[model samples]
Target: MRVLVVEDETSLAEVVRRGLTREGFVVDVMHDGQDGLWAATESAYDVIVLDIMLPGLDGYQVIARLREAGVWTPVLMLTAVDGEHDQAEAFNLGADDYLTKPFSFVVLVARLRALIRRGAPERPVVLTNGSLSLDPVRRRVLRHGSEIALTPKEFALLTFLMMHAGEVVTKATILDAVWDPAYDGDVNIVEVYVGYLRRKIDTPFAEASIETVRGVGYRLLEAGPAGPAGPAGPAEPAEPAEPA
Candidate 1:
């Protein structure tokens, strides 16, 4: 998962970046609150590590603005102040979790993982659509209890789709959600990754679950021997909507 750390303290930020990178997460750091806020808003970050005190904008205002704008990306607020009132305020402003200074690196990682899981729909880190299950945190996938190996990007794509299972998602939406905004969109990388996913996630299974909407996009449907069936009636005809 990608994590954006908004901190003005140079040494502290470096420590966090190094520690988190070593933990296998893609990390980005910003010294100013406005830049942090923009990156957090524009980029595909799983969790945002925001410090309370900042330049240009304070963490309180940043968090408030993000929540007010309906950005539900999970946030883990960090502050040197350990006051209960401050914690309450941060949570009220939509911070998913909070940590004070002098914290252990391990505890922070644990908290981050816990908060991401809480904010995300996946429980037990296992996403299920019929018998197919992918454990994102563990980077493991199983179909009918059989293990399947998937590359990091393929796993990220599958997890993103499965997380929004049963909902039709557009290519642009998928791109922005699963990839960084800096990614080149002119190429057919999304299609290539989808093909990779199909080869691994769908071919081994008896029935296909990922449905391509010719003009709209793709939807991860339930795998059924009788074909796709859901409460919304027959799956809507596939169509990839114009990129947003």
Candidate 2:
């Protein structure tokens, strides 16, 4: 899963980043409210942590604008002010949860997990495609009742693919969601990780779940045996005329 932390306090932001990274979440940080708002709008994140006092925009305006623009990614408002009206304002502006400063990091993690679970569409606890299962909270993947070990990056990539199972996802989409916004590396890095995943998740099982789409991208097969089931591949040519 991915998280966006929009806090101006450098020390606090760094602390949060280290803690969440240890917990196996791909995290992005923004110092100003405008940057945070823009990042939240442009990218797909599982959850966001926004601090109230900011340089460009306040947390209230940020959350309000997100709601106005229909960006429903869960937002957890952070502020030093603990006034009842302030909390009320955040909720009214569509903040999913609120955390006051001097808060417990342990409690914050728990709250973020709760928000993710509540925001998930159907199966919030685990994401499954066929017999393959992934527990986002536990950061574990299981296939055919066997546990599959994956590096953090590999796990994040697979989780994103599994989240959108059966959909043909483009390389750009994968880069945006799986990697940080500041990543200046080649996009082919996606292919590298995909290859790593295929070796572990598909090669052993003899399952072509993650399939290359030729000129397009890749898809994770859903609910059935994997096959050449996506858009038709290059068509065969007609036979030459035999007339004299």
Candidate 3:
């Protein structure tokens, strides 16, 4: 496995490099936050060992900036201070693992291996599209950071559309994916619920995001200059959600 180590302390960085090399890893060390961030972005490493304290930008900023740019490489944070708030901040800023100073190299190796095993960027948090975001686990939806209320059926329908965002999903497709086989309602019911969804998600925004394909179906178009929202969801963060 290849690893990127960002540590300002030269001795500590070398020790980490030697230890990780002993553990079957190809290691590269960067002592500045700017250099580390550049290396993290330019190099393809299986995992990153980042120190929270560095020049130019801190570890938290490095992680956040990388994530904002869609570089989802796994980050294992290495720091000297130990505090509950620090740990929470690391996670909030997208650190996968945290370790205090004076740590065991063995435990470090073990955590690095575990982090690498989990593989790609699989965050526990739900996502947002356009001005809309939903957490199915919590049955909640948010628009532009403000929570938007949705009824059970409305939530189901919106979820279906957002899942197929940018696509011209027909009423029949909505019925099959959202409603139960036992449902005996008119397929026109899809239009009713689509209206319900618009009341909260789209109408609140300046430009209407959802569009109708005369006599065909409906699609959620992004309000940007780059064509419609496309099947990708929203502007850029149209996160690829799994099959519901």
Candidate 4:
């Protein structure tokens, strides 16, 4: 295993380096946060042992920047502050594991092992097309970075379209996916919600993200310049269905 230790305490850092090396691990030591962050990003290490207090960027900043840059290497924070808030902040900023100062070498090694075994959890990605963004897990929608309120059904319908952006989705297909299988209500509900989505997600912004294909269905335009809203004269008509 390869490890990078970012503690500034010379004696403590040396002890950890020697100990990990004796355990058959390749170790790289950095005495400050700037160098630590640079090395962590520039090198591929199995795990990182980070100290919260250090010169230049702190542990929180280093990890935050790393994550912002989409680097997912596992990180274990080593810090003297054991306060609950500090720990919470570390986690909120994306530290994989946190160990307070005065920690035992054996315990540290074990924690590192556990983190490696668990691996990095896949980060959820917010779906985006143009100014619109949807976080399915958080159930949040943003347009141009501003939150847009959506009813549950509206959210479901919009999500379906966004998921299949750029494709001609039939009204029947949408009804089957977004509404209950047993739904025997008006099929025009799909049109109504599409209108609602356009009003909120497109109209005010002068975007025609949802395009109607008269006698067919609709499509959520892929991100970029959009043409006027209305029927995209039949190229491939959606499989015929009872009029919505």
Clash pairs, model 4 backbone: none
State the lDDT of candidate 1 residue by residue for 1-244, as single tens digits. 8899999999999999999999998999999877887787677788899999999778997876565333567899999999999999998877888999978999999988887777643333456777787775556888777899876567768877876788898888777556543567654567767767776766566456777778788888865534332333234333353232
Better of 2 and 3 by TM-score: 3
User: For residue 61, what is the lDDT in candidate 4?
Assistant: 76
Tens digit of per-residue lDDT, candidate 4, span 32-90: 87788778767878889999998876888778756644456789998898999999999
Q: What is candidate 3's lDDT per residue for 157-238, written digit by digit as tens?
A: 7765665667898888777556543468888777767766665676565445566676777787643433223332233223
Give the lDDT of residue 182 in candidate 3.
Answer: 45
Off by over 4 Å in 3: 123-244
Give TM per candidate: 0.54, 0.53, 0.54, 0.54
Please say which candidate is ahead in lDDT: 1 or 2.
2
Q: How many backbone clashes does candidate 4 have?
A: 0
Residue 225 error, candidate 4, Å:
15
- Stretches of candidate 1 exceeding 4 Å from the true structure: 1-4, 8-29, 32-48, 51-75, 78-96, 99-124, 223-244
**Model 1 deviation from native, Cα RMSD in Å:** 9.3
lDDT of each: 0.76, 0.79, 0.75, 0.78
Report backbone clashes per prediction.
Answer: 11, 0, 1, 0
- Which lDDT value does model 1 have at 200? 70
Lowest lDDT 10-mer window, candidate 2? 235-244
The local lDDT score (0 to 100) that residue 224 gets in candidate 2 is: 47
Of the two candidates 1 and 3, the one with more favorable lDDT, higher being better, is: 1
